[model samples]
Each structure stands twice: as structure tokens, then as C-alpha cells.
Target: MYGSQLWNITSLKVRMVYTQWRKADRQVLSVSYMTNCDLLPLIAYNMPLESILDCKYISFYKFIATSANKFVSYTAKSKIFDYTSTLSKNMAHLMHKYELDIYEIVSLSKYKVKDHSYYK
Candidate 1:
């Protein structure tokens, strides 16, 4: 996750990795195959990896937006607002799920609870 903000969150590799993570979580927690995904957070105390990654992307851009370098700030703001970009689409989905906007990303970043519980 050191530089994951630059990754395409919708890629096939990301999905496969997330699947592996879920399988590992299920095994580690001794959860039955029939167990509810929402209940995983209650049991394991962690958010889904992708969700955290999405948050990290937003946070990293927020950091970039603060840069004094004109080129850096320009690029960050450009990517963030580009409706045609994949990152923006993911951001929209995430924001819709959490009822958040660009300004609130930081607030969510400081979240104390490790669990996603679908982050509901």
C-alpha cells in the first residue's frame, strides 16, 4: 500500500487479490462458507482491503493537492476532477456508498474502526 494510490483499482489483478484476501480471511476466522460478508468485520475487525485502498487513493490525492509545486497540484486536481477517469468513477461509487464528497475524504481517513461492515 506504500504507493497504491497510483493503481487502477478496477483491474483484474486487484479483484483476484481481493478474492484471495477474502479466502484467507475466511480461513483465518474459521468462518463457514455460508457466513455473511458483512459479519466478517464483526469477527475480524477490519475493513475490506479494496475499500481501504480506495480511501488511500483519495487521501493521497488530497496530499498531492496540498503540494506547493504547480505541476503536481495541477495534475492532482486534474485527475481528481476528470469525470472520464477511472479513479473518478471509483471515487463516485465510493462517495455514493458512504454519502461523502471530496471534502469528507480526509475525515473518513481518520476512521477509528478497522472494520468495514460494508462501512455502513
Candidate 2:
């Protein structure tokens, strides 16, 4: 469903949480995507949201964004949860730290939705 495929995605959401065992904490998240077509990739992507954001336990670059255009707003059919618990007090006090809260991906659409759902 990446390129030039018709998708009837009605809604999408995620359910996830962190579990602490001993001194280390790990997160377990369940991802469920509802679409007319099978959504294996979508489900797989959502499952790692928590782990991707973990700096101490797991390290990876992460981005989150909404799909929006000049005339329309896109709701987040996907969600992400960071499950590494809070940063240490020493790291939190660092003055020369950087953080990025959002990122965007571009998609081109050949067709427009003219249904009442688009306005809603």
C-alpha cells in the first residue's frame, strides 16, 4: 500500500505501555490498524515507537508528524509512546542538549476525496 494503491483506511490507533523489571524498563505496545487492505507494515511500524525513543536502552533516530496540506488537515491515525521512563536527573540538567519533537514525510496524491468525510 505504498504507491498508487487504493486504501480504505477508516481509522487507526495504538495501545502501548512500559513495564519495569528490576532496574531496567522495557515497553510493550500493541498496534492495531484498521484498513480495507491488510496492513502488516503499518502494524509493524507502530510496535517500535516506544523502543525507538529509548535513549539509554535503545538508540535510534525518530520522527513523528501529521499529513496536512494547504486546504486540509489530517488526523493522526497512528500514535507513538516513549517508554524509557524519565531521563536521569544529571542528563536532564545538561544545558547543551538538543531535542526534536516532530518530523514530516511527503506523499503525493493523484485523487482528492470529495465526500463529506473529508470536511469532517
Per-model TM against the reference: 0.71, 0.15
**TM-score winner among the candidates?**
1
> Candidate 2 residues 1-120, lDDT tens each?
121111111112111222221012211223322321123324334322222222211111111122234222222222223222222221222111222222311121212111111221
Residue pairs with colliding backbones in model 2 are none
Cα lDDT listed for each candidate: 0.69, 0.21
Candidate 1, residue 58: Cα displacement in angstroms equals 1.7
lDDT of 1 at 51: 69
lDDT agreement of model 2 with the native = 0.21
Give candidate 1 misplaced runs (Cα > 4 Å): 83-86, 104-109, 112-118
